[model samples]
Target: MTWLIFAFLNALFESLKDVFSKKGLRYCDEYLVSWALWFFADLVLLPSLFFMPIPELNARFWWALAIGGTLNSICAVLYIKAIKLSDLSITLPIVTFTPIFLFITSPLIVGEFPSAIDFVGVMAIVTGAYFLNLKQRSLGYLAPFRALMAEKGPRLMLVVAFLWSIAANFDKVGLENSSPLFWVISLFSFISVALFPLVVYKSRNFTGKLRRGWRSLALMGLAFAIAVSCQMQAVSMTLVVQAIAIKRTSVLMGVLWGALFFKEKGITERFLGASIMILGVVVMSLF
Candidate 1:
């Protein structure tokens, strides 16, 4: 049950991160926003290492960090690019597909398999996400699928979701070998460093971009730090798929933010879709 609390908190903070990241992306390229995500998160999280007791690291921890960090660094760029290229409501909800992919990766990587009921809940969430684009159905029954294929953002986000499913299992392994905070700190550190060269290469007027967008980037970093910390804590306490299923509720909040902040349309259908996602989360959590 405590894991549920952390999971929900993860959802809240994760949504905040998405909103802030989307705002920051207005002034910075995906490369800079992607790098700043971990960089700023490291700024917020690194300080806590001094206050917390250092945990003993193992080979497994380092291995998971390296692999997961690489995958997530790639995912971060794709994710930011997705949001930059399309509506947040459209691209963000596509992440709900992660739980579906997790059904395969979790068992193979972490030896954890979700039950039938969990599958049902995952289906509901995925279905609800599909409904986020329900307006597309006006064109045809398969219009949503067609719309997804037509949009670069949703397509890239689909890749991010699949990669995340695989990376999350590594996250569980990393958590098993180290404390949650330590694992998050290490992972962020690795990703920030890995993306440094790309950020430098792809970004022009980097200092100016940072200077102009520092507030949003800083908020994005803080939100991301809290989100991942809560997420790792929840993951440490529950099955990876279950934990991630709960976190995917962020899509609901992302949709609302899209409506409120960005004035994106289709709110009626998206809200209905988000409501179904909430029901699915409840089923997964309580049953």
Candidate 2:
């Protein structure tokens, strides 16, 4: 498949993964569910080593893996925890904050400065995020921002966004020293291994939880594996922004699934808000 096709597939599978994860989270411990995402997916990815050549290790690759893998583990935990704690529509849309944070982080880390269009994109994203909670506008104009601050999930996701912004650059550094497929495999392996202690400590009945939610967890893991693989393939084939801009469409899918499957509240507004947020991301990418 071409990069565009893979990028679109990545978005579709990512949405499916999030929906399945939220479904599993309803019955399983969030920590265990988080572990299942990486653990089961790692199992699926392990056999691919026979088909692909192993990447040579370097200090840059190791440092990037250590930092990026640790942050990714933190993000995985926080992301699932947010799903457990808030409406899918609400929490998923908030992740759009990542690009917005990128506008700040990119210049500092990578020396990539934002353009005037970047400012406009940032404004558009902030506006969309505001409208996400427009259902609570009866309280005041600041209700949406207030809701973001008051909710534990949104607050945690906010931090997750910033961390991802930083980790993303390290991923590029890793890619500079290795192939994308190898990078994906190495990254996930490290994450699964690194998360072992925390997952075991935080989840008292991890095995039981995995058994209870095995089907959903398996589906979630399968989706994640495919999505991330496609993402890596897509990124390797084309501009990273092209792959990610398409992948961010997952936010819209999350909104749709939130309404149809989960029956979350305020679907219309959230969908509109997420669409706007995604559009802003597209603009950020194009500019």
Candidate 3:
């Protein structure tokens, strides 16, 4: 039950990180924001390594880090780009598709297959996505799905979701080979370093942008660190599925943030749709 608290906290802070990233993206390029996320998070996370005993490394750990870190670095950039290019309500809800993708990637990467009940969850996700753009249904029955495909942000986020499914399997492998804290620290550090070269290559005034947006970037990183820490702690205490289902609550929080912070329209539909999607994830994860 205590794990529930940490899981909920993970959801809250994860949403906050999205809010901050969206806000930061207003002034900063996606590259800078993406790099800043991992870099500053590492700044907050790396210090803790000194306070805890280091876990023994293994070939499996290194393999997971290499694969997951590279995939996540690309996902991070694409995620920020999605947010920058579209509304949070539109882009964030699409992330819920990750679980559906996990049904594919997990079996291939980790040799784990979901039960028959998970099919119902898949249908629910598809249905919920339809409702997300219910306002567009006047155009046609398939309009909502078409809208999702037409929107670059949602399309890119779908890619992020798919890549995340693969990375998540590696994350499990990495955590199995090392402590959660060490894995988080190592993965984040690896991503930060991986993205640094691209951030420099893509941005003309990287230092100036960082100097200007340091506060927002730092806060976003802190939120991300807290979110990941709470998630890892919760996972340590509970089933991975349970922790992840609880964490998907961030999708709902993201929709609310969209309405509140950005004053994005279609709140009633998006919120309802996100709620349904979250219920689908919970169903898949729990039963």
Task: Report every candidate's CA lDDT.
Answer: 0.87, 0.86, 0.93
Q: Write the per-residue lDDT of candidate 1 for residues 108-148, one digit (tens) a residue.
A: 98898887888787878877876877878889988867876
Backbone clash pairs for candidate 2 read none
TM-score of each: 0.90, 0.95, 0.98
Residues 167-285, candidate 2, lDDT per residue (tens digit)?
A: 88888888888888788888889888887888789888787877888999999999999999898889889988888999999999988898889888888888888888888888989
How does candidate 1 score on lDDT?
0.87
What is the Cα-based TM-score of model 1? 0.90
lDDT at residue 180 of model 3 (Cα atoms): 86
How far out, in Å, is residue 128 in model 1?
1.5
- Most accurate candidate by lDDT: 3
* Model 3 pairs in collision: none
lDDT of 3 by residue, 1-287 (tens): 99999999999999999999988886789999999999989999998988999888999999999999999999999999999999899899899899899988999998999999998998988889999899889999999899878999999999999999999999999989998899999999999999999999998898998888888899999999999999988988999889999999999999999999999999899889888898899999999
Once all C-alphas are superposed, what RMSD does model 3 give against the true structure? Answer: 1.0
